[model samples]
Target: MVSPDVFYGALTRASGRWPLSAAARELVRSGVPVFPCVPGGKRPLTEHGFHDAATDPDQVEAWWGQHPGANIGVPTGAPSGFVAVDVDVHGPVDGFRGFSRASRAGLAEGWQFLVTTPSGGMHAYYPATPGQEQRSWQAARAGIDFRGDGGYILVPPSEVSTTGAVAGYRLQRFNAGASSVLDSDRLRDFLDPRPAPRPPENPGLQRQADMSRLAVWVAARGEGERNRGLFWAACRLAENGVPASDALDGLSAAASDAGLGEREITATVHSAYRAAHPTREDSASPTVRDSSPAAPDDWFARDPVSRPSSVRGLG
Candidate 1:
């Protein structure tokens, strides 16, 4: 498989209008297998979808000749030497935020270029690991999808007809940094993490496992209640003897999935634990014994005056 950098270099150098037929042939000549999708759409024109991708020049010529305007489909992962992190923008969900979170976590990076999809989404192409097989996955809630092994992507110069307008996939930008293989597994985990493992034999861990529902509830918390909800849930765990660190471990990812920032999640969990078990300095208990006195010297014992003498005007 040719590196994406090399593939892209040759692809851009090919001169022409890059019409469907010409672009298909050019991809074949550049050593990337190609397939046809329905004209102005994503559904495969061939019977087997991406499995029909071929590098043979004659097959390429025949397919494009028959369907002159079929969109170009390139198999990702090993077949094309690259995988894509697809950022979907739909309704009220903007995947760019989730992608940003992944990038901050050092998961999604080193892409060849960003392809603007017809529906205004983005496809970030990254080099695939040579020997490793990274399967594709979709985090629907996060609005991000991975196109790796067993998946395909529509490349540049392919147009999709939406409503009434014809919008084409275009190169948004090229990455100047060193392009490296993305860890798709890690990226998926960061975006939409799985639930904690089943209950373990250890009693403490077993108890923690039983509280996984709390984490799920926290993740489902919406805008106004996210922080307060997480704090309340964490407090329940802490009050039941769940360690602060364990609470952090269990709730951090869930709270993050619910749209809480890392720092806010940490602080909230710690706050819950603190609230569950207040510190000596924050305790409100009386320092002296309750039975010690109610005498003049025991003014301290007189129900601990609700107001200072000066405020009460007691001379």
Candidate 2:
């Protein structure tokens, strides 16, 4: 894999007044796989999205030859040998403050390069740990996203045109100091801290706290795992002695935010409840595949009464 510094250098050379096709070719030549995105936008132009990213010069040439204006998209983490901390800047949802807090906590330094995104946001680049698997996650409420494994980011010079206005990503700063691999887990915890479930003398307070954290976890789940995550969280609540109704109520809005419908959320919660307490009294057993006995150490696994929970981010 190409080093982060080499990747950043290639990107810098390709950016600024270079044709989009030239930029795409430059990256593939550096052993960085890249794909074409919609002209002036972030949407993937290919059928399989970032999965179609390729390092082959001919493949990249064919792609850009067809759409010269397409923006360059590179998969993060293992595929590109780098990860990104995306600080978003949508209206009323600036992430700089949270990023600043992370930096103060000494969790946001060691970035290889800082790129200014089209929307006036920031994408801080960091080298991927050589053999570690860091998955992607979004702390939407925090207005930040970690583009690690299973995620992609538009490289410098990619433009976004909205309402006839066009803006491009630009390399703003390069860190000449030693670049370090980011501990995505630590950064996430610092950005959106959740209390570890504990045995409480105040049971009511404990339930509320656990449910809140679980709901936040559900809310943060990304596509392809929303339903499964909700089920796991609901099951955690059930295993912790919380009622089914409360689980539904606690996780409803969060599930909704994660793009699950009312019915799906309701069904998943009920299924989880049944799975947690499979009694003959349950007239109809849940048949959903998610209800199939999850191992104690599955994604977002926890034994609230015995130990701390370990939540997995999207991958």
Top candidate (lDDT): 2
How many pairs of residues in model 2 come into backbone collision? Answer: 0
lDDT of 2 by residue, 140-236 (tens): 6788999998789999778998658899999999998998889898897787664466555565675687788888878887676588678878877
Cα deviation at 38, candidate 1, in Å, is 0.3
Clashing residue pairs in candidate 2 (N, C-alpha, C atoms within 3 angstroms): none
**Worst lDDT 10-window in candidate 1:** 299-308
What are the runs in model 1 whose C-alpha is more than 4 Å off?
13-16, 197-315
TM-scores of all predicted structures: 0.64, 0.78
Pairs with backbone N, CA or C atoms under 3 Å apart (clashes), candidate 1: none
Any idea what lDDT model 1 has? 0.75
Residue 242, candidate 1: C-alpha displacement in angstroms: 26
